[model samples]
Target: MTDKRTTAPALLCDVMIQIKQRLRPLESQEVLWDQAAGRVLAQAITAPVSLPSFPRAAMDGFAVRSSDLEAASPEQPCQLQVRGVAYPARPWPGTVSVGTAVRIMTGAAIPEGADTVAMLEDSEVSADGQFVSFRRPSPPGRHVIAVGEDVRAGQVVLPAGRVLRPQDVALLVALGLTSCPVVRQPRVMLLVSGSELVPPGVIPKVGEIVDSNTPLLQALIPRDGGQVVEVLRVPDDPVLLRQAFRQALTKDIDVVLVSGGSSTGDEDFCPCVLAEMGELVAQGLAIRPAAPTGFGWLNRAGTLLPVVLLPGNPVACLVAYELLAGRIIRHLAGRSLDLPHCQRTAPLRESWSSPPGRLEWVRVCIEQNQAVPLRQRGASSISSLVAADGFFLVPEEVTLYPAGTIVTVYLFDTLSGQQF
Candidate 1:
């Protein structure tokens, strides 16, 4: 009996909505402050104690009552007796009396009865080390950072669902937090299958191609906040693929990505094996370069696991991941439902063309504020992805966009030598 499982390609927006509705979020876990970088915060953080927590000198200077230096100048300086030195680690010995000053270093606590600071450049010390003369007048509270000025106690330092960056971690450390509650990284498994595929660093024997999808997906998954737990290779046999899928689902796998066997060829048995073992949600998408992509759900160990089938072509695989897998990964990590890349609009230097009824992702490079389409070399060319700055989308309704049309460019990097 012939199988009748082929379904029409689903709209891109509909597929995304379905994914958002079906996938469940992962749980939160405690992580050290250092390990929390790039992880989303599970709870809001309030400052336990104020930064600095004390009034300190902002620079190397002498602390004194401002009224005493009212008549001070370069030609006629005000002289005061030297009291004591105030180092950051050691407090001043006594309060400043009238006509007396204390020598203080930067960040040292200001002493009692001192209302102003006269910088070292504007003050002269006597040879006997007994007196200091101020050449310029200083206002009360000048050069002094008041307590809680940087961060007040009980202030909200970080909000929930924020992705922690290096600066964010530093701020948490400054606020005296040794650890943070962050959403746990999702566990992912990668399965690459093909009979004519060989491992990287090995010379392919004439008709074999080196497995690039494994490394590609490995880097992409972790970069998007999913931890890769296992990567395995299987031959063009349905039994091996089915066994591997079931084994992974029985473990603590949150998602499974299968590459290179999603199409309907004689050896392309991924869709069939997955259909026999689980429920297929999507058979295809109306998307250029990655129409053979598919998604499904498997029940194992009393939990549902999402398995996405990516195209064999390198570029198509990357595109499919960005479209579907990225959303699920971000959701599992408690990140916002938005692409992490910085987006901008640029005019097209040349007109773009695509067949109607499919969403197309056109690789483009930014040159002189113009988006220039990269040379089309089909979906297997990895070099095109490397040379591209980002991609511009062509909606399914339109077939052509004229030159000089401003289009949104979803950047892969900031192009400012920084990753988003």
Candidate 2:
């Protein structure tokens, strides 16, 4: 398991160079308050004013200054004249000369002269409105709020490259900010090439099947944080494919994905077309079911737009995209490397065989804690992938397994919510 292989479609130079090169950063723009949730912040966000502006009451109890309640104890008593309840920004009754108290409601501003106001539960009131007694002594600075405690004015609350969460939106609103800056979504262009492929609704004359890759790809593009600006399909000809690539680059696409015509067959003109677009770093890999995967770039107009030529098989194409092309897309979108790939350890139900010097990913279903290998591992058929929850890798160095051995499974579907 510790051994490694350097079987990429391109040279190490191209791969490393492209990863180091920083593509165009997303645009900076403002969005409405309600719509700013889950967007990246393009600029540093600072607080215009201190949070709470004033020492607002966090509870419904009375507001107090620390000095007045220094010696209040349970055994001793204190009394003050009953002042009426105070409202927000209202005038105080007057200064406290000696042994005087004010009745304050929750969130009311403290009077100018009053140093502290004790809670009603802590003191007993007299019918004469002049006596109050505390059974227990109270502490100073207790139950008091200070200004600028939560956040200070001009303080940077959120930094740039910060992706705003739902709570972030609320915090920005609390700071009196109306809009926020965010990056622009990445744009993608798709090209599907093959003469044997026909549209689904078209009645084929002979030797033709409906093209399923177009609809499948169109549906998956937007979910990966890239917008599908356009999806084009053309017959199996180099002229058409080359023309499509040039036309797509003119429209300013961040990445271009061309499906089919990537194999080693004579009709496979995608590699030639790819060489013309950008220099081919590598043309083949050591992986099974996708050995013919090609990598290149469109270096026209100083835009080194990476092009991923996926195999024609639907399952192979998708899995390859998820494993390889998915990484490039994440790089473009400024996302982390940790994709939602699931991992699990399941018992092998039975033994299996694979070709030598090749890594095989076998689809399996978890049935009663056993990894049941699907009967058919077809490269072209997409139906086999529908019921699979994960795949167990048969390493090139490994070709045999006992029934009960523990094998790590790279899950396709989530193995969540299990009682075990």
Model 1 clashes, total count: 0
- The global C-alpha lDDT for each of the candidates, from Candidate 1 onward, is 0.88, 0.69
Tens digits of per-residue lDDT, candidate 1, 363-419, equal: 989998899999774889999999999998899999999999999999988446643
Compute each candidate's TM-score over C-alphas.
0.93, 0.75
Q: Which whole-number lDDT from 0 to 100 does residue 369 have in model 1?
A: 87
Off by over 4 Å in 2: 1-35, 41-49, 73-138, 144-162, 196-211, 342-376, 390-420
User: Model 2, range 239-342, lDDT digits (tens) per residue?
Assistant: 88888877877886788777888776777788777776676655764556666677777786876778888888887787667656666765566554444457
Q: Candidate 2, TM-score vs. the true structure? A: 0.75
Give lDDT: candidate 1, residue 265.
Answer: 79
What value does the lDDT take at residue 276 in candidate 2? 67
